[model samples]
Each structure stands twice: as structure tokens, then as C-alpha cells.
Target: MRTRGALSASGASVLLLALLVLVPIVVLLAAWQQEQWATWQHLLDTVLWRLVGNTLFLMVGVTAGVLLLGVSLAWCVATLEFPGRRWLQWALLLPMAMPAYVLAFVMVDLLDYAGPIQTFLRQWLPVLPDFSARHPLWVVITLSLVLYPYVYMLARLAFEAQGRAVLEQARILGDTASSAFFRVALPMARPGIAAGLALALMETLADFGAVSIFNFDTFTTAIYKSWYGLFNLQAAAQLASLLLLFVVVALWLERRGRSRARYSEIGGRQTLRSRPRLAWGVTLFAFAVLFLAFLLPVSRLLYWVIDNGLMQVDARFLNLIWRTFLLGTMAAVLVLTLAGWLAWVKRHQPSPSVSVAVRLATLGYALPGSVLAVGIMISFSAVESWLADLGVGIVLVSTLAALLLAYVVRFMAVGFGPVENALQQVRPSLVEAARTLGASSAEVGRRVYVPMMLPGLLTALLLVGIDVMKEMPATLLLRPFGWDTLAVRIYELTAEGEWQRAAAPALTLVLLGLIPVMVLTRRRSARLS
Candidate 1:
């Protein structure tokens, strides 16, 4: 009976989480019930088509750029013998530490006509044409540079897993190295590559910061403008609903691609041999990517910090750091608790409905932070109104409760992956022994599972904490008065073209983000070893 009670509790928790995820989505969809014909007409008459076109164009450009950069680099790092193969492989991932918007502002600062690069160029070549940093092409390039690591990491794994044995077979069948890659390796790695591409594209679709920094308009930006600029919540909701459609499609493609790729991984780590000259060339290529994507932008940020001195790190700055850390901590704990409960319930109950519920709960990660911020606010405001009509008064909107809900919705999946994997690692015999010893499900969890899952739990905590700190759109929109985080600070500064002032917060976020990247690399290295 005790075990059944524990199971019931866990199941109830899962249902509640599922409901939380559904509320925002349902609210966004139901927003159509209110007719804002004027706003709709203005959007349609002016910027709707342009938004669609620019969005599609950015997606296409980013797709091409990431594929080329991600696939080629993955191929080199995974298959080739290089001078710094080991270090280059890891260094390539450092770009992931820099958010697209951070890179956006840095690039715009450095490469703008008035910035250092063009200024230096004009001194030598007087005929140099004026280049605009806000060009759509530059926006794509900036995003690609930061986002390609998603593809590189996944594609490299796919290649490293199956490249050696298959490539040898292709060689024996009279295939040249180039032809073998095209014919044998590329096809086999397609599903993984597709999965990674889907992720990059989803991020591209959801991006608000980079596009906004570049003065580029997409659905996310449109949604923001509608809400804060136009003062039309209905218009924002309608835009969010449309953006959610794109996210759903991207999510479906990722899952479908993963399903097909399930059997593609075959184990081997042997690398292809390369000549000394070619190896150095590969080293140079990898270094160039690392330099441009990470090193250059970071160097520029550091320069700004040094040039500006300690002016930015005053009392207000300390408070920003404190609030950011506190919020991250609160959100991390909440997400970890819920993720643990979901994992435990899945382990014990194991039903199709439970699986679906878990899926729904985690889907929040794919929804743009902007979409979630708007949807959640609308949902809670409606709840407050309904309660008021019942002679009950309460406030949720603009509260820490609302902000934390957005954080949970956005990051539950980040914590769940680690915790679920940890649960699976627990030996089945140990679980059965606990049952034989007459422990209830709750006791077994507290005694056996929690202790064993500590490492995964810690990992989840760090990951979710860092992610929440880096999160901008939700926190920016939902934060209560004086609740500015590092992300929000950077966004505010960059919005007003204060790139130098924004450097300190952007650098702080980059440093914090590195914690997860280092953790991931170390974990991957340990697995390989």
C-alpha cells in the first residue's frame, strides 16, 4: 500500500507538470478568440510577408552555413590525423559558450565601418566599399559561427562511431577518399546530421537576441514588438502561435530523424591517416574556426573590459550578479526536483500515458523563450481574472512565481535527460533486492536511487543553472521590478548600442556557459577512454 501511495504521488506530480506545459500552449492558441483586426491588418499590410521572407531566408542561409562548417569540420576532427587533433576537437566546442547575441554585438562592434577592422582596411585600400554589419548575410554568419557546434558535436560522433570500418570497406571497393566520404560516410551519418541541423534551425527560429541586435526581423522579434512596442498582447499571442508551428515542425523532424538514426551507430575510434603537410593544413583550418568564432570575439570583449576599467562593476553590477545567481539557483532546484520525480515515476509505472506526459513536459525546451514568456503571462493573468470573478484575489503575473514557471517550462528537459539516464544506470538487481528487503518505493528511492543518482543530479543542476542565467527572452519579459539578470543587462545595453558597457555581463555569461561545455567535453572524453 505504501509503494502504491508513492507511485500515485509520483504519477500525480507528472500529470501536474504535463498540465503546466499545456496551459501556455492552450492559452496561446485560444488567444485567437479575441479579434484584433486593426493589429492584424497592420501586420498583414506591412511587415508580415517581410518577416516570413527574412525568416525563411535566414533559416536557409543558416542551414547551408552550418552544414558546410559543421560537416566539414566534423569530418576533419573525427576522421583525420592532425597535429592538434585532440585539442582542436575540444576547442571547436568553445564557441558554444558564446551566445549568438554576444557574438552578434561583438562582431558588429569590430567589423562595422567605424569599428577597427574596416578602419584599418580603409587606411590601406581607399577604394574599400562601406559594408553594413546589419546585413542579413552577416546575421546568418554570426549565428552560424555560434550555432554550428551543435551540428559538429553530433556529426563527429556519428562519423567517429562508424567512419573507420566503413571507409576501409569503401576503399577496398575502389572508392577514392573523397568519393568514399560522399558515398559511404555521408549517407550513414545523414540522420545524425539531420538531427543536428534540426536543432540549429530550431534555435535559429527561436532566436530573438541575435536577430534583434542585427536589426533583423523574425517572428520572435515581431512578437516582442507587438507586445511591448505596439502594446497589443493579442498580436503577440497570435505571432507566438505562428512561431510555435515552426517549432513543432522542427521538433518533429528532429525526433523522426533520430528514430531513423537509432541503428546507425557502430563502434570504432580508429582515425584515418594523413600526410604531415595535410595534417598541418587541417590543424590550421581548425584553429582558424576556433579563432574567428571564439577567440576573436572574446578578445574584443576583454579589450572592452580593460579599456573601460571597473566602472561597470559597481553596486548595481554586484546586485545583478546576485539576482542572476539566486534566480538560477531557485530555478535549478525546482527543475531538478520535478525532473527527479518524472524519472522516478517513469521507472516505476512505465506506461504509454506516462511517456506521453513526460514528452509534453519536456517540449518546453524547444519553445522559444519569447513564446513561453508571452504564453505563460497570458495564462496566469486569465487565471487571476477568473479567481477574481469568484471573489478571490491573487496575483501571479509579474511575480517570481510566474518567472520561475517560465524557467521550469524552458529547462525541464535539460535536467530530465541526465536524471533519466542516471536512473537507467541503476542496477536492476539492486532494485529487486530493495523490494525483497521490504522497502517502499519512496524508501528505495531515498535510499538507493538518490544516492546513486547524485552525480547526474549535480550535472543537471549545473547545466540548468547556467542555462537559466543565459536565458534572456523569458527573463527579460517576465522579470519583476529591479530583477535584472546578466542576460537582461546585456540585452538592455546592446539594445541602446552600448556594446562596451554590455561587455562585462556578456563576458560573465560566457564564463558561466563554459562550465557546461567543459563538463560535456570531460564526460565525453571519459566515455571514450
Candidate 2:
């Protein structure tokens, strides 16, 4: 009877989660099917192919740039001890604290002809031509700087964690260092490298802020324009469906790459890998990458804030910060609650249906925020329609509730992944023992599992909070009237080329972003220690 009760509870919880997760996808499909054929034809005739081409171009460019920079820097720092190498180990990650949009604005202003860099350059060399930041090259460069840290972090960890014994064995078999690295170390690290690239590619695909700021059109921007510009939700829904196809393909590639790469952990008590002596060539190269990636953009932000002074942080600014913080907190709390429930269900009762639901729920991480927002609006509009049909005037459309719901759908994966991992780590023996002591499933969770999952729960909260705080496209697409966040403020101000005014909010976002970076750093430190 007790087992049956547990199963019943698990089934109920899993079913609810599955429905909630399915809402957006189902709504998108329904919206697409119900739309006039003219809408799809209009998209096909005009912007669909262009959006696909631009998205693919940016994805390929950014992926290539990130891989080159991330892997090289990872190899350099992991193997060659250089000046400031220890500090570079952590400082390389600072750029991760800045959103791609923030980086976009910084790069645009600093590299502009009227800006200091060009102003000074023209003074010495009158032959230099003025360059526009809107160029596709600049967009790729700006995004690569902020996004490369994702790759760098993962590749560094992978490179450091590799089996040093294998490399040495290859070398002893008359292989050169370079040859051993190419044949042995690189293949073993492919899984981590692939995972990092997958993350970067997803971020690139979902990027509306950077692309919009730079006037680069992609599927994300197209989806937004379809909904707002053309005022056609059906067109938006169809575009989002197309975006999902891109995500599915990327995920399949990532999975295939990972499956083809494997490493065995056969040996125990592995010795620490020694770093080679610092060479000036390597030292300068590391510093150059660090200075370009971290010091330049951050230094520019700090400078503008100081130069702009107190006017930037007036009553309006404080309100923006407060609203942003409150929204992020509420969303994070709600997501954590939903994540905890789903994680518990997956842990307590593993079934095929539950597994599929879990996959569907977490898959949004690969989706662009604009796609998610469009799908969310479709679902929300349906609920509003149903409510009106039932003779009630209350509607979620254009309400704070709608925006928060969108955040939950889009960012639940950000919170859930960590919590699910924590849940997976909890010993089944411990849960079984607790049940043997006459504890109900609920009590067992509260008394035994909750405490154990606290670390991941906290981590999830921080991650979701930071992501919500940084999120732009979804918030822009779904926010209620008069609802403005720091992210939105930054987007608007930066769009108008108001870099000085945007600096304060940008700085705050970066600071709020540091919470996750600090968490990552502390965790890495703990592991190393």
C-alpha cells in the first residue's frame, strides 16, 4: 500500500510537470497549424532564408573563434607556466560575467571612429579609414570575446583532468610532445570541448541582444519581428518551430561527438601534472589574450561609470535595479520549486514516461530566448482566450504573470540541471533506510533528501537569478507595460548609443553576474584543494 501510494504521488507529479513543459511546444504547433498559409509563404519569400543564413554564419564563426582561442589558451595555461599564469587561470573567466550585449556595446563604443581609440589613431595616422561596429566581423568578434570563456572554462578543466599517464606513455613510444597531444590528449578532451561548443552555439543561436544591438539579423531576431513588427503570432510560432529544428540538429551533433570520444579512468591516485618553465613568447601570448578578453572591456566599463559620475545612478536607476532584482528573485524561487519537484520525481520513480518528460523539460536550454518567448505568448494567448470564453475578464496577456511564466519555461533548465545532478548523487540506500524507519515519502524527502540537495538547490537559485537578471529578449518580448528591468534599460540605452548612461546598469548586471562566476571559482578551488 505504501509503495502504491508513493507511485501514485510520483505519477501525479510527473504528469503535471510534463503538461507544463509541453504547453509551449503544443501551443506552437497548434498556432503553426492554424495559421494562414500566406504567413508561412510570406516568411519563406522574404526573411526565413536570410535568418537561417545569418544564424548559421554567426554560429559557425563564433564556434570557430571560441574553439581556437579557448583550446589554445587552455593548452597554454595548462602546460606552459608563464608570467601571471596563476592569476590568468581565474581572470580568464571574468569576461563570462559580462553578457554578450554588454560586451557588444563596449566593443562598439571603444572601436568607433569618434571614440578614443580611433580619435587617438587618427592623430598619428591620417590614412586610417573609419570602421563601423555594425559589420558582421565586429559582431562575431564581440560575441567571441564574451562567449569564449565558456569554452575556455570547460576545455581548461578537461585538459587539466586528462590522464597524464597516457600522454607520457605515447611520448615514451617515440612520440613527440606535439604528436602525443594531437593523438592522445586532444581526443580524450573532445567530450568536454564538444560540450562547451554546444553551450556557445546555443547562446549564439538564442542571442537577440547582441544581434539586435549590432543590427545583425538571425532567426531569433526574425521570431521577435514576426510577433511585434509584423504583429503575427502565427508567423512567430512558425519561425520558432524552425528554430527548434536548428537546436535539435545541434544537440544531435553534440551527442554524436561525445559518443565517439571516450576516456578510461583505470588508474588510481594520479600524480599532478607539472607545468613547463615560462617562456617569454608564451608569457606574452597569454597576457595578450587576457588583456584583450578581460582587462579591456572591463576597464572601459569602469572608466565610463567614473566619467559619467552620479547622474547615471539617480532615482530612476535605483528603481530599475530593484525591479530587476525582484523579478529575478521571484523567477528563481519559482523555478527552483518546480525543479525540486521534478528532480524528486525523477529520482523517486524512474520510468520511460518520466525520462521523456525530463528530456522535454530540460531541452529549452538549447532554445533561443526569442523562440521560447514566442511559444510562451502562444500558450498564454490560448489561456486568455479560454478564460474569456468562460465569462471571466482576467487575462495573463501583457501581465507580469505572463513574463514570469516565460522565464520559468525558459530558465527552469538552468536551475533543474544542477538539482537533478544533486538528486542523482543521493544514495538510494539512504532513501531505502529512511523508508524502513516508517517515514512517508514526503517526510523522507524533507528530513533526508532536502538537506543533501541544498548545495545544488542554492547553486540552481544563483544560476537562475543571474540568468534572469541578464536575460533580454524574453523580457523584452513578454514584459508587461511599465515593466522595465536593468537588462531592458541597458538594451534601450545601448540601442540609442547611450554608452555613458548604460554603464551603470551594465556594471550592476556584471556584478550580479559575478555570483555565478564566484560560485564556479569556489567550486573549482574546492576541487583543486
Candidate 3:
């Protein structure tokens, strides 16, 4: 009777959650009901095609850049031995600690005409050509530098999991090392590499901060312009729906690319291959990437903080940190709870309906935050109006509840991935034993599952918390009045071109982001070892 009751309750929750997720998508689609033909015509005449062209261009450039950087770095770290190879394996991930926007503004600060780089260059070479910091290529490079780890981390695992045996077999068949890598190892790692590529592309599509800094127009930027610049929510929704189409197409292509391939890992401790000249060259290349991506940007941020005293942590700074921490904690707990419940239900029920609902529920992670923000606000406005009509007088739009809901929708997959992996490690036999011993469902969960899932739960919390802290687009659009976070603060300061003043919040975000990067590095290290 309890088992049936639990199943019914879980199914209800899953269905409700799935519906809640679908609300935003539905609202975004229904936004066309209120026709804004003038706005559509203006967008089409002026900037619509430009947005599409720039977005596709950015995607193509980032795709090539990340593939080159991620795959080569992953290959070098996973299969080759070189000077500083062990340290570089994890050090390469440090770029993930810097938000692409932070790097974007920093690059502009240092390299733009008014900044130090050009100032110094002009002193020696008076006729230096003026270079635009707002170039679209810079946007692609900035995003690729920060986003490449998504590809590298996964690709490294794929290569490492293949072990030395497969490569050795290929070499013994008279294949050169380069030929063996291209033909044998690369093809086998295609699924993982593709998965990583998809993630990187999704992030690129969803990015608002980086592109905004570069002044490069894309769908994300267009959505923002429509909502804030033009004050048209429906227009924003229209643009968001278009961006959603891009995301769907990217996901479909990624899925189709890997659908027919099957990969089996030959698991063994990979013996690192050492080639002296190639090893040193790889070391040089890796160092250059790490320096440009992580070290240089970080040094500049630190310099801005110290050289410019406006960033001194005062009462306002503390309040910003406190609010950011509070929001991150709240969102982390809420997302983890939902994710854990969903994972548990899937474990117990394992039905097709539940699986489909869970997938739909987590699909929000692929969506741009601007898309989610517009959809959610539109949905909330309807709810607020309905409540007002019923005399409840409760408000939802621009409230903390709305913001948290956006966070949950945007980050459910982030929390779910860790919790699901942890839950999968819990033995079914152990669960059955608990059931046979007369433990109630609640008791079994508390006594058996809680202890086992603690590590993953903590991991989920940390990940979700950090992601919430760094998130810009949703927070910018959905935050309540006077509830500005570090991310929002950075965006505001950067928008005003106040790079020096923004250093405090940007530095704080980077430091906080490092916690998760360190966690990932440690986990990856353990696996490789």
C-alpha cells in the first residue's frame, strides 16, 4: 500500500514539475497572440538578419576554436608525457574559473587603445593601427578560451578510458603515432568529444554577458534589447523563441552525430608515451594557452583591484557578497531537493512516463537564461493577474520566488547530474534488503540513501551554488529591486565601461568559481590516477 502511495505521489510531483517547466515554453509561444507587427517589422528592417548572421558566425568560430584547443589539450594531457604534464593536466582547467564576460572586459581593458597595451605600443610605434576591441572574432576567442574545458574534460576522460592498449595495437599494425591517433583514438572518442562540443555550443548560444561586452549582436543580445531597450516583453519572447530554435537544432545535430556510433572502453592504466621534442612543444603550447586564458586575465584583475582603491571592500561590498551568498544557498538547496527527488523516483519507478517527464524537466538547462527569464516572467504575470482577480493580492513577478524558479529551471540538470550518478552507485540489493527488513519508505530513504548520497549531495550543492553565483542573464532580468548580486553588479559596472570599478565583484566571482573548478580538477585527477 505504501509503495503504491509513494509511486502515486512521485508521479504527481513529476507531472506537476514537468508542467511547470513547460509553462515558460508555452507562454513564449503564446506571446505571439498579442501581435506587435511594428516591432517585428523594425527588427526585420534593422537588426534581425544581423543578429542571425553574427550568432551563426560566433557559433562557427567558437566551434572551430574549442575543437582545436580542447581536443589537442585533452590528447596531450591524457596520452602524452612532457615537462609539467602532470600539473598542466589540471592547470588547463583554470580558465573555467573566469567567467567569459569578466575575461571579455579584461581583454578590452588591457588591449584597447586607451588601455595599457596600446598605450605602451604607441610609445614605441606611433603609427600603430587602431584595432576595435568590439570585434566578433574576439567574442569567439573569449568564449572559446573559457568554454573549452567542457570539451577538454570530457575528451580527456574518453582518451584516458581507451587506455594504451588500443593505441599500441594501432601502432603495431604499422600506423604512425599521428595516424593512429587520427584514425583509431579520435574516432573512438567521438561520442565524448561530441557531447563536450554540444555543451560548449549550448553555452555559446546562451551567453549574454560575453557578447554584450564585445558589443556583438546575437539572439541573446537581441532578446535583451527587445525587452529592456524597447520595453516589449512579447518582442523579447519572440526573439527568445528564435534562439530556442537554434538550441534545438544544435542539440539535434549533436544527437544525430553520435546516434549510430557505439564505443566500448578497454580499461587499463594508460602508460604515458614520451617523445622529447613533441613533449616540449606540447608543454610550450599548453603554457601559452593557460597564460593567455587564465594567468594574464587574473593578473590584470588583481592589478585593477590593487591599483584602483575604489574596490575596497566596504559595507556595500559586504552586503553584495551576503546577498549573493544567500541567493546562491537558497537556489542550491531548492534545486538539489528537486533533483534528488527526481533521481529517487526514477530509481524506484523506472517507468517511461517518469523518464520522459524528468527529461523535459531538466531540458531547461539547455535554454538560454534570457529565454527562461522572459518566459518565466510572462507566466508569472499571468499568475499574478489571476491571483489579483481572485482577491488573493499575491504578487509573483520580479519577486524572489520568480528568480528562484528561474534558477531551478536553469540549473536542474547541473544538480541532477551529480545526484543521479551518486544514486546509481547505491545497490538495488541493499535497497531490497532494507525493504524486506520492514523499513518504511521514509525510514529507508533517511537511514539507507541519505548516508550514501551525502557526498554527491554536497557536490551537487557546491556546483549549483557556484553556478547560481556566476549566472548573469537570469539574475539581471529577474532580480527584485535592490537585490543586486555580484553578477548583476559586474554587468552594471561593465555596461558603464567602468572596468576598474567592476574588478571587485568580478574578482569575487572568479574566486568563488574556482571552488567548483578545483573540485572538478581533483575528481578528474583521481580518475586519471
Best-fitting candidate, measured by lDDT? 3
Which model scores highest in TM-score? 3
| lDDT of candidate model 1 versus the reference | 0.89
TM accuracy, model 1 = 0.95
lDDT of each: 0.89, 0.82, 0.90
Shift of residue 6 alpha carbon in model 2, Å: 3.4
Candidate 1 residue-wise lDDT, 1-529, digit = tens: 3487776677777888998889889999999999989988999999999998998898789999999999999999888888988888998999989989999999899888799989999999969985887889999999899999989998999898884777888899999989999998988888889888987988898788999999999999999899899988888999999988888777777777668554454567775767677888888888988998999988988999999995657899899999999999999999999998898788878778788899999878888899999999898888999999999999889999999999999899999999999889899899899999999989988999889988789899999999899888889889998899998999999999999999999998999899989998998899989
Tell me the deviation in Å of residue 344 in model 2. Answer: 1.6
Candidate 3 pairs with clashing backbones: none
Between candidates 1 and 2, name the one with more favorable lDDT.
1
RMSD in angstroms between candidate 3 and the native structure over all alpha carbons = 1.8
Can you give the TM-score per candidate against the true fold? Answer: 0.95, 0.92, 0.96
**Quick one: ranking by lDDT, best first?**
3, 1, 2
Model 3 bad stretches (over 4 Å)? 1-5, 432-447
User: In model 3, where is the ten-residue run with the lowest total lDDT?
Assistant: 520-529
Worst lDDT 10-window in candidate 2: 265-274
Better of 2 and 3 by lDDT: 3
- In lDDT terms, how accurate is model 2? 0.82
